[model samples]
Target: MLPTRYVRHSPPKETTTSSVNEPKISVQVLVLGDIGRSPRMQYHAMSIAKHGGRVDFIGYQESTLNPGLVENSLITIVPLQPPPSLLRSNTLPFIFAGPLKVLWQIWSLYYTLGYQTKPARWLLVQNPPSIPTLFIALIICFFRNTHLIIDWHNYGWTILAGTKGPTHPFVMLSKHYEAILGSFAPTASFTVTNAMAKQLRSRPYNVRSPILTLHDRPAAIFQPISNSEARRAFLARIPETSGFAAAIMAGETKLLVSSTSWTPDEDFSLLLTALCHYAESTDKLPPILAIITGKGPQKQMYLDRIASLTSTSKLQNITVATAWLTAQDYATLLACADLGVCLHKSSSGVDLPMKVVDMFGAGLPVVGYAAYESWEELVKEGINGRGFTKSEELAAVFEELFADREGKQLARLRKGAVEEGSRRWDEEWDSVAGRLFGLCD
Candidate 1:
């Protein structure tokens, strides 16, 4: 038998503010990742705070929180302690134990909320680590009468499928479980792209609540910098590059930057191959410095590959550097680069890469690898950047962009990148957030 589809008859109405005498609205944001790393959730929290709500942000602890967020009186951060080493190291046990801990903490918070004065209460949760967490949240919301709002990034099942293949029993179970839970009617739901929104709407259990697209945007800190200034800053940050200082100072060097998650989904090997092709294709090519950012499970594997290339002298003229940069340093590094290479082939082919957005915000032209069609929205060939399927095609695109003797092509692409990047997607979040928090009139 086909599953019944739940549908909403009306779109969400604008939420109005209470009278001056009334208590302010309150929100509890639940995320399984580091709040510092989850920019979308952070933006939503900031928006709620901006609109006179008290936001309780609950998430895993990190080394630091955003300084501006820390200063916001309307927001209080509660960090979740990590699980014990035994559970953390065992994948299956951690999966079951982790959500149980989150459920307990949330229940404790719910108990605390009972003592507080009456106000509009909402729970905004980020998903994938989705299933058991959302399922638990639904139970709590049922008892507390708090409105639930889910920000869908991708299905936890799809992520599992990436690692464990589609036919795995766990993957199949997760997929079925997510569909069932995702269909419960919430106050509203949001996703990062229109494609993702469409996918969520099509879910059988989806109770047709208003699902809106909330695209990721670069923060204000990512602005354009002069090549000279950026190069100087880059050199200062990594003093080991003093050997290339003379070449960079003389304008005989090009900087290529790639931001990656270092996962299998992103084929960094393809990018390394492209670089080797770029080197061997032309002797006239100037010295190239490549900076690959972000740290993940596959960092050592890529580092070993880079070392192999170095030892073989295959890329003697090309210097590759990798670092896991802080937000501030990452932004600065993006601003200094000549070109950005995005190796991300989306794991689910639904979520767009925010790294490309940050790169564009820094006015850096990107050559991206597209696993699906939706990527075209960002990497428009000849408009802002180019997209490719194979290493050779990407190498060819790189050759054209970097090997231009007259410099006209590079200048034009840079202009396109800056123009396209200057459009602020972040500004749209304020209105969407207002609607989500019932702060809008």
Candidate 2:
């Protein structure tokens, strides 16, 4: 349940002279989306609290939040009401729906920032809902004398362009809106990638911000389940694997996991096609239990398609299950799985997938889509994971990686993934964001 009222925390006092010189820190970590789905911002709140700063975490509480965030004394979860029903209706075209949603969001955000919350030294906000958020945040910061920091996950305009064509008037206007407001608070901006920083520095966007690249890293909960007993216990709890329990436990079948939002960015058809090809191949590869998790608009459509395929016996050698697991169960599944498949086709070519990071943290190798240039930063082809651009290519990669009876290639990739996973959230966050926010000693 969401907290019904706001309560602020004061930072602990120290008598040291250095403490006297340091700035008093309190930040409102704002996300204009679901709080549970916004892991990056969640990490930010945790890191801030760890560094002795107080955080008011604000977002819609549509899903379960991390207990760590909820339990922290330094962090407060402030829930925002979800948008109006009319804004969510598919019958309403975006041309009309977009403006109405923005207007409501502006009022809600203003009320929360202006009156409902305590005044803070900094306001760290997520971008890509940059439309009303950037505008409203700027206004609130100006009036309340709070410093604004925009964390650039991706461009709102580019994401908008993905649905409506790049030439759409709204897309163009959104780009201008982002460019104008996003350029403010020049020294206080952070981006997820160097590519984003470079883009923002050049051309029409020409942001003056001292953009720091703070890459996403897996949280502490995601770790390798090397103990066979632990793996067995996890598998036993998931009823979806009951049909092929022996095969999976005895290493006669492979567990392949993937997470998706079932959004337009990911083409599930490609994965289905590759799985079909894998089943038909006369290869030595084991049968697969492909489990995809997450809820989205296209989830039902894909579920129907998977059902249709199963009814016709087209996927005889493969079993597909879709689940909406809790965060802990999701981490355990990643740790127990043999491999992960990431179908993310980044809407903004500069943004990297957090799922890939989570998979690596579980010591699981990945087979990721290679459509975007930024994937190279995380995938590290032939090392930590392999990349494929087509269904046939994916099938071929799977055959090569999984066909060996000795499991040589899989072992090699898992070693690389484990090494990659060792570079975790705390170390990365403390160096970059910790210093930028003046939370470091």
Candidate 3:
């Protein structure tokens, strides 16, 4: 049987010449990135499907999707073709590969939307890979008479500036392209943060769009563990974590967990340096087993560093483990851990980290990076979590949180996280996005 959330209420059968139970609206939810990795778009599709709207869900099928989404009858998965393999070659210059990749995506996306799929009433797309996607989606929507809605996750230009300097001609050009096309749907667009919406409305971009802020919320699977035994049972099931189960269950070791994409935005070095501080300190702190999860381009590079750090006699109190967990297992692991640590320094300060949202949902206190101004919006320092810009600051926070063996401070933060997690995705979506999509009153 499907989970209660997955179970759909089928519309009544047609009684006359016209189908009475047919969905009144059909939406095309687009993401240029991997569908499995894009949880926000998936949630949008699920919400649409739940409210009797047909959703043509489109993106690259890079990983396993949520079972609930896969089982949804009202939603259709429209897989986008992955870009050329040459794009990944380190030897091939990006100047040559970048244009080729964009051209390929343009042709592929145009073909998928124009020829393969049926026309949707609304076309909702994720931005940041905005160059060709936004242009191509705009053309398709214009010709098809569909309403175009750009879901601004972050600025493509800002993310590009991370690699190429902000002054670079290519980055500047990309910014203009994004800003112009993104401003098309003035009143119908959405953003993840108010700061982003404010920027679009005020700056050189000057978007007329009333970009609504639709904050990310945890899915139903992200819930607090009821007891120690339940947490231990969950830990024992995963092969990578099974060895630490007994120690965790016995309360002899503090379990710290973090999830990362091993991307450029996340400063893993800060986390490693902080742990090094914890190891070298003379203070008698409890042994910590830090589990860093996620697979990405930079995983092996960090894994080698972890290996070198452990070889030295200077770091004895800390054990660092890495794993790529299934979605359900990841939630369970977060619930079982003592604390959550985030290193996601957002490319645009406005956007919040969904990983932090997931941690709070599992009732775990977080210690997150504080370089970005927007960190305060999600992680209220000294409340649900603490934020630090430097390794020393993070190390000090760890000392303070873990100083008491009884964990009074950790308990207080955990209580705050539980309160924050009380609100789930369904209610949030119904209240905000449901109205925008005309799915609910």
TM-score of each: 0.86, 0.94, 0.94
Instruction: Report lDDT (Cα) of residue 13, candidate 1.
Output: 30
Better of 1 and 2 by lDDT: 2
Q: How well does candidate 2 match the true structure in TM-score terms?
A: 0.94
How high is the CA lDDT of each candidate model? Answer: 0.74, 0.85, 0.83
Among all windows of 10 consecutive residues in model 1, the one with the lowest summed lDDT is 1-10
Ranking by lDDT: 2, 3, 1
Candidate 1 local lDDT, 117-209, one digit each (tens): 222377788987775567766765665567888888777888878887999887888888888788774678888778888877775445488
Clashes of each: 3, 1, 0
421: Cα error in model 3, Å: 1.0
lDDT of 3 by residue, 1-441 (tens): 223332224422222221225875788999988999998899899888887888899889989998878898878899999876777567678788888888889888987887778777788999878979988887776666677888888889888999898999989999888878777643377878777778878766777856787888888989999787788788898876688889877667889999999989898999999999988888888888999998888999999998999897546878899988889889998999999999988887888889999999999899999787677878887789999999999999988888777888988999999888889989888888888877777
In the predicted model 2, the residue pairs found to clash are 186-209
Q: Is candidate 2 or candidate 3 better by lDDT?
A: 2
| After superposition, candidate 2 runs with Cα above 4 Å error | 1-24
